[model samples]
Target: MSTGQGRLIIVVTVCVAMLLAILPMPDWARPFRPPWVTLVLIYWAIALPHRVGVGSGFVAGIVLDVLTGALLGQHALAMSVVVFIAIQLHQRIRVFPFWQQSLGILVLLIVEHLFGLWITGATRGTAPALQYWAGPFIGALLWPWTFVTLRKVRRHFKVT
Candidate 1:
């Protein structure tokens, strides 16, 4: 794909993922909601670091914060950390099999969650809940399918 086309695809992908992340699901399912946007952004940041980076992550997070009506930097901070780690480990991470990559994604999600909790605790004066970590675990479980499907979409669209 041409550079412009590739950039467009990445932007559309990120926006769709963010919209998915904030959609109103059933209450019982909310806790299990995977960080869909975060995972997709991190995957791209790792696979196409030249196209996705911390700036994209920060913007995505800020947009999410606005959409979700959460603290301004909550998602931004969490996503920034995820993208940072993904970029830092991009070399080793890209070579891993799907399962291994999922595991790494699990770790990244957990770190993001922890940072989120720390931030929440600092600002909201609330204790963290075990449920807070569930999103990452579920997100990690979905990573394999997410990675494959997104790769297919990218290829289908003739994106590089």
Candidate 2:
């Protein structure tokens, strides 16, 4: 594929992820909503660190903040940190088995949430309920399937 095509595929995937992030859910299911944008950014950061690193993460996070009506730069800082870590460890992570890779993803997701939580607490002077932490766990559980699916997409489109 041409360079522009490859970039377009990545952008499209991220846009879909952002949509998923903002999709409506029943109140009971809201806390369980996986961090879709974070997961997509993680996949790309791991698969193509050079092409999608901290800048992509920051931009994705900013868009996500706007889409979700979240505090500005909240997701941006969190995502930049998460993607930086992923880029730093992508070589080792790429060699891991799926299960181990998921574990790594779990760590990254937690880190992202930590930053978010800190920002929330700082802004609102209140802590979220325990359920606030559930999304990362769910995201970790979904990592294997996400990884496989995105891998197939990348291969199909010859995204490099």
Candidate 3:
């Protein structure tokens, strides 16, 4: 796709992701709410490394931070790390089967969650419970579908 069209798609997807990030959940399900922005970032970084990287991640995170009303840089720091790791392994991970790519996404989500927890603990407080750790698994479980849908979007937009 043309660079302008590719960028528009990115903006649209990121806006949708930001909306998902702040949407409220029931108390019982709140902890399972996956990091939507992070998942989107992971997919884009892998699919089009040239267009999505640390800077995109940081900008996405800051937008997320604003959306969620969290301390500035919380998502920024975590997402920057997540993007770095994804970019580092994208060459290898992209060749893996879907299932294997999902596994890689699982690891990346877990690491992102841990970084978020550490930052939370340092800046405010963290909940020490399985619930706090559950989002990654849910995110992993959703990765296959997420990847498939995003791949379709990329193809439809003819993004490079």
**Top candidate by lDDT:** 2
Which tens-of-lDDT digit does each residue in 15-52 have in candidate 3?
89888877888889888898788888999999889999
TM-score winner between candidates 1 and 2: 2
Question: Which is superior by TM-score, 2 or 3?
Answer: 2
Candidate 2: list runs displaced more than 4 Å. Answer: none
Give per-residue lDDT, candidate 3, residue 49. Answer: 90
lDDT by residue (10-122, candidate 1, tens digit) is 88888898889878999878878889889899889887887788989999989998988888999899888789889999999889998899899999999888878888899
Local distance difference test, candidate 1: 0.88
**Model 2, residue 101: what's the lDDT?**
93
Clashes of 2: 0
All candidates in order of lDDT, best leading: 2, 3, 1
Per-model TM-score versus the true fold:
0.94, 0.99, 0.95
Cα-based RMSD of candidate 2: 0.6
| lDDT, candidate 2, 10-120, per-residue tens | 999999998898889998999889999999999999999879989999999999999999999999999999999999999999999998999999999999999988999
- RMSD of candidate 3 to the truth, in angstroms, is 1.2
Q: How high is the CA lDDT of each candidate model?
A: 0.88, 0.94, 0.88
Stretches of candidate 1 off by over 4 Å are: none
Choose 1 or 2, whichever is better by lDDT. 2
